[model samples]
Target: MASHLYGNYFSTRSQRVLFTLEELEYPYEWHSKDFARGEHKALPYVSEHHPFGKVPAFQDDHVKLFESRAICRYLVARKPGHLTPPFAGTSSASLVQGARFEQAASVEQSYFEPPLEKLGFELIFKK
Candidate 1:
């Protein structure tokens, strides 16, 4: 089954998912949503793609997903060993790596992204 992404190019969250897809070298179709025209809030986009009318919605085979972080995690889990360490093993080293990965991700989400997002919004959108 083919993978598909419905998102806007200007959306940072969409960029995150796009980066993950590129890093994994995953093949997928990109359906660009026209934010200017409120395409994301229309029709099947809101009803089928993303319930909240948000960008970066993804579909892989029968699985539909939203949230950039969730999409990245699903892509990583599907194609492991490139962007992440082996998470399947029950060994101590594997567990440590997994914990570290989660910690770093949490830090980025909680600490790094919020400030950057706020700054971007203030500088770009607010202007």
Candidate 2:
């Protein structure tokens, strides 16, 4: 029920949410809000869903959520299966793993963003 996806297959953030949803076994409505075509900049739905013009945002029950980690945590709490720990009754090791996951996720973001930005310009813009 949250906002739908709006990015291509190669979008790491988008893929992360999709895989989380899949692991959670939650059905969702999916959309591709392609930034390469400037839809995130010009589309009305883009503004309606995400004022900041970012992808992987979600809408549900009139409440909106943003960011990939937030979305993943949301799904994990709402439809937790085996992909993540429980919402409030998590144990210490689970909490530690959660922290570790977050650390790795942050590192993944830090590691990939610049190269992807360069590749984006090179592959999509430098023509």
Candidate 3:
């Protein structure tokens, strides 16, 4: 696999990763973790990939990464001018821009994600 994505189709976290890959036009092999079979919770996969046993783990030739947003950021960094504006230098403007980006990302993680994740869990996974 050129790159591999381990996730279920319906997971929002997985969707974020998929959207990033699509936006970047990057190709990856999708490995669906069968939720019905409890495959994501298995021993070696969980231990080696995600200790929390979450879906949406990613592996490319050089690295293994978990967390959807982190994976997206990594992908963007690989081709820095796409998806996000590059923080290319240490000029005052660049520093301020980088800080703003970090703050916005923090806001999404802290304020935006919890509620949406809860809603998705209740509506889709709670059954």
Candidate 4:
């Protein structure tokens, strides 16, 4: 199955998704947009793919996905058993496994990320 990633070098969120794809050995076409020119803010790219006109919009056979984190999750779910085991939706044991994964992910998002993100914004992006 072919997939496309729309992004540019400057977006850290885009890089995150790109890194995950590389780590998973998932082959995809990369479509670079001119961020300086605000090309991503235009139509079709924004309206058809990403509602927010964000960089790192992803499209595959099944769906078009926006948001860097969601794109990463999709890549993992699409090809499980490589880096991560498949989320078995039909079994209770697997459901518990999913819950635990969610818990850890929640901890990272709720606790670990906020301070780090703030620091990153102040130190890196807010120049």
Candidate 5:
């Protein structure tokens, strides 16, 4: 059993996950959740795996995990050859990099959300 990646295709976090997986050269199954179809709202599909009904969930062997950054860090640590610090066991660089990326991504979203939603409402929804 390798792993499974569940996310909306082209999502920023999802892209990051895919990039990290590719960098690590890990073999995994990918399931693209459709946003337009409201696939993420399905309880049976999410409750079994995700408590928050979110995308970018991961499953490997008997363990299941969520959160894009966490998954990326796990991949980098476990598969050092992929996007990890050169001195894996002796260095904290990879961990630091993962943390930095997470912070930046979160910040970008928080900064963009208000303006984005307002634009969509005024331009698309005519509100």
Candidate 6:
């Protein structure tokens, strides 16, 4: 079965997942959630997709997931050698490359996204 993404166009989080899907050339269906009407906050979206009523909830044949980054990770892992370094091999160089990739991802999540989100909220959403 094809994957399904429940998200809003206005959500950057949703865009992230969408971008990942496109970059990986993954076949999927998009379900646009109406944030203006609070569709994300209502059932059965809240119960089935995201507990916090967030955008970019994902479902595949094998699993269901929320959070854009996690969904992106899963997608990338599904089709390796495209967005990620080849760490499947047991070589030391490959291990180091994988560690570096994880470090960079952690830095972006921990150090970059928070401030950038705040800045976007202040500069764009607040205005």
Tens-digit lDDT track for model 6 on 1-127?
A: 9999999888999999999999999999999999889999999999999999889899999699999999999999898866975576879988888889899989999999999999999999998
The TM-score obtained by model 1 is 0.88
> Which TM-score value belongs to model 3?
0.89
Ten contiguous residues with the weakest lDDT in model 2: 80-89
For model 3, the stretches where C-alpha displacement exceeds 4 angstroms are: 123-127
Per-residue alpha-carbon lDDT of model 4 for 1-127, expressed as tens digits?
8899999987878999999999988999999989778889988788888888888899998799998888998888878857675577769999998898899988987898789988999999889
The most accurate candidate by TM-score is: 6
Two-way TM-score contest, 3 vs 6, winner: 6
List, residue by residue over 82-122, the lDDT tens digit for candidate 3.
Answer: 58776769999999999998999899899999998899888
For each candidate, what is the lDDT? Answer: 0.92, 0.72, 0.88, 0.87, 0.77, 0.92
Clash number by candidate, in order: 0, 4, 0, 0, 0, 0
Across residues 64-91, which tens digit of lDDT does each residue of candidate 2 receive? 7778778888887776567655334478
Give the TM-score of each candidate: 0.88, 0.66, 0.89, 0.80, 0.67, 0.91
Q: What is the lDDT of residue 59 in candidate 6?
A: 98
- The total of clashing pairs for model 6 equals 0
lDDT by residue for model 1 (34-126), tens: 998999999978899899999899999999999999999999989986687557588998889889989998999999999999999999988
RMSD in order of candidates: 1.7, 3.7, 1.7, 2.4, 4.8, 1.4
- Which one wins by lDDT: 3 or 5? 3
lDDT score, candidate 5:
0.77
Q: Which runs in model 2 stand beyond 4 Å of their true positions? A: 1-3, 86-101, 111-127
Candidate 6, which ten residues in sequence have the lowest lDDT sum? 81-90
For candidate 3, the per-residue lDDT at 11 reads 82
Q: Deviation in angstroms for 126 in model 5?
A: 12
